[model samples]
Target: MSMIKAHHLAVSYGHGEAALKVVKDVSFEVQKGETFGLVGESGCGKSTILGALAGRNKQWTGTLEIDGEEIGQKRTRSQLAKQQLVFQDPFGSIHPRHTIGRTLLEPLEIHGKDRRQERIEKVLTDVGLPLNFRYRYPHQLSGGQRQRVAIARALILEPKILLLDEPTSALDVSIQAEILNLLKDLREREQLTYILVSHDLAVVAHLCDRVAIMQSGGFVEVATRQQLLENTVEHPYTRILMDGSRGYVSERRKSDSAALPA
Candidate 1:
């Protein structure tokens, strides 16, 4: 079952002559329970596509269908609730002054969902957080814990799809792994679909089943995980990303080896 379908999706800022099209003609479909990735350098329109799908960016022209329904620029509460976005920075996205519980409660209140307390507890547990932690503010948590809360907030609505915008980028290297693992586990446990946007192929490889390589506002290639692992991607840009990732890994390995005492 296709959870999301988009075609000729162009998202822009401003209007008329001054309008800058950040995402050019791009199209893709994400299946249920699948993790689809958009991997590209910054300013390559990766987040723009996510914003368009999340209905945050209204200057878009395309045919977008979510869970078998065609979506317009404006969405109803129910339509908006069908998908949720997890931003790049947990510290920035989550309110510093708000308790985790209060933060989670805001969306449920807005959507007027019932059993709010039960939902909040369940989602916190789902994201590997203790129930009592909800009373704590974002400043009280570590980077990884804060991200788990962010994920918890996104999951509280019980949306079928999650739009992850560089979800682990702001964390420490070790914390990034923990968050990625948490996301992988959540996807299966919740039967959720994800559209992950990132610049790191390794991160995408960790969670994504398929990846779309974008450059200059459009997709250059969409390759499967197998192709990435086997180094069999046909597109030059895909190969470049793979090589770049490999080079980073190689450098990290060298650094680690150098730091090891004999």
Candidate 2:
């Protein structure tokens, strides 16, 4: 079953006399328990599309369905909480002033009045954070730890679908690998449907089952990871991105190779 569906989604940033369409009729579906990646260069409306799914932008015009229910133009808090968005920058997503416990409790405090402590402990354990470190502030934790906290906070409400907007982009490669694995395992255990947005094809290749290539606010190509990386199909936009990424690697290899023995 599809967890989320977006068809002919168009987002405009301005109002009245100066309305500009940033996203141009993008259509896609996110399957349950699978990761659907949205990849594109900066300013390509990837995040704008993600915001539309999370219901962050109200001005967008399109059909958006979450769990078989058509989401209206104006979303209520309860309807909004059924899905969650995990941001690109984990550090920015979490508040420095709030400790882990306080951070995790923020959503529950507003929505859930009972079983707060029990919920906190469960989410913490689920995200691989212990209850003892719940009092630690964001500054006191490592990058991975902070992200885990962010994930915990997102999962505390138990949303069925998570819109991950470059969730691990800011972290180092080693840490990113760990976080990705954690996300995969958690999604499997918790049965989450994810819409992952990133600039790296390699990252998307590793995590997403299927990927959609976006350019200039439109999806020029959609294919599985194998088709994207291996098949090297013939969309001009996707080819450019893949070629550029490969070209960079080729140049880097020559540079590194030149420094070694013949």
* lDDT, residue 115, candidate 1: 98
For every candidate structure, what is the RMSD over all alpha carbons to the true structure, in angstroms? 5.2, 4.7
Each prediction's total of clashing residue pairs, residues at least 3 apart in sequence or on different chains, is 0, 0
Off by over 4 Å in 2: 247-262
Q: Name the lDDT of candidate 1.
A: 0.91
Q: Residue pairs in steric clash, candidate 1?
A: none
TM-score of each: 0.93, 0.92
Q: All candidates' lDDT scores?
A: 0.91, 0.86
lDDT of 1 by residue, 1-262 (tens): 9999999999999978999999999999999999999998889999999999998999999899999999998899999999999998888999888999999999999999999999999998888899999899999899899999999999998999999999988999999998999999999988999999999998998899999999999999999998777667878777667667776566776566435442
lDDT of 1 at 250: 68
Q: After TM-score superposition, what is the CA distance of residue 53 in candidate 2 from its true location, in Å?
A: 1.1
Winning candidate number (TM-score): 1
